[model samples]
Target: MIHLQFRKVHGNEGESEAPKRSAAARKSIGLKAKAERFASRNGSRSPGKSPKGRVPKRTARLESDRTSVASAIAGTRSTAPPRPRSKHFANAVRAYEAAIKLMHAEDFGRAIRSFEDLIAEHSEEPEIQERAKVLIHACEKKLHENER
Candidate 1:
């Protein structure tokens, strides 16, 4: 009776049932287990294991590429062209001349203030920068003498 029941069960098998899972699914499951184990051992989401828990070679290569792009952007920003000066050379020269005139008239305070304004306005000019420094020293000397 048991053999007859086994024959009856085996006789009704059909070809249209769900197909068995392919080898790829089994490999994927194995890979998933390996990935979980790797994540657990490293305490972080490291790509793969190395001798020192270093990132995988492919991930390191990507990191290097990102660094290179960052460096290139920085270089481009630094090498960008400077804008044209708003205050022309003639205007800066006139301002310097006016400050000198005020200094010669013994208005040391006003002259020093004008020189500071000129310096702030034309910081790119070497002559104005030097003159500003000299006028600052003169103003300091005059202030010291007036304090006596």
Candidate 2:
């Protein structure tokens, strides 16, 4: 009978199929360690200020102040809903009229698209909805006529 024995090495004892670290991993680790050491020595000074003197105000605070100043300059809070139209239905009427004109002109493609836009934007307007349906039918008739 023959007896075989194995002795465990210190670094390779438990590493059966562990992958080796790539060069990129080693570089990243070195950079992170250097950054940590630099931060520790600097002790919370603003990024470009001298470490021997008092730290300056943070650039992040300046950014927030600028944003508030910009909002003041714009003269209104951003919470307002967007304007529906210059006169709150005038623009929709204009678009609806344009669609009707296109339908009358036998420009079925643009007419259909315009009517679809009006219906999407102002579906609650009964007049516009009715007009859109009529214009759609007219556009279909014009398209069929053109195909013939």
Candidate 3:
């Protein structure tokens, strides 16, 4: 049974019943609840293990790599790897150096294009991708400054 409360308006001329929600209208909410349920049901995290308050493996690896790169550039050589890196890695290094050369040459427009291309082509190298993104932003800033 639904109880409707009536309120009298000015001059006692109008009476309005309170709004009531139907049964079917109660469950519809935002997409966040649905997404949480879907992610939990999927393998986003192990069923037995809690993902809260934990850094993901991929993020940890990227952080370590960034630190190693900073150390290497700061004149402290990184430790030797277990094996030689692949040719693709070597090619990416060369390409990144070329883009840096363009930046040094003050060719911000071309450097931005080069960095964008590197990002698109070298999806496997997150470090390079991140560096390229930073460079692209820098280049865009310089280009905008020069235009002003």
Query: Quick one: best TM-score, which candidate?
Result: 3
Candidate 2 wrong stretches, greater than 4 Å = 1-86
User: Candidates' lDDT values, in order?
Assistant: 0.80, 0.77, 0.78
How well is each residue in 1-148 modelled by candidate 2, as lDDT tens digits? 0111222334555455555579999799888778878878987544665655467768999999999999897886556786465453787889888987887787899999999988888866777788788878878887998899
- Candidate 1 per-residue lDDT, tens place, 28-102, comes to 978898988988898766555445645446888889999999998987775557767555877898899999999
By lDDT, the best candidate is 1
* TM-score, every prediction: 0.40, 0.40, 0.44
Q: In model 3, how many backbone clashes occur?
A: 0
> Candidate 1 clashing pairs?
none
| The 10-residue segment with the lowest total lDDT in model 1 | 12-21
Candidate 3 structure quality by residue, lDDT tens digits, 84-121? 67888888888999999999999998898889889888
lDDT of 1 at 8: 75
Candidate 2 local Cα displacement, residue 73, angstroms = 59
> What ranking of all candidate models by lDDT puts the best one first?
1, 3, 2
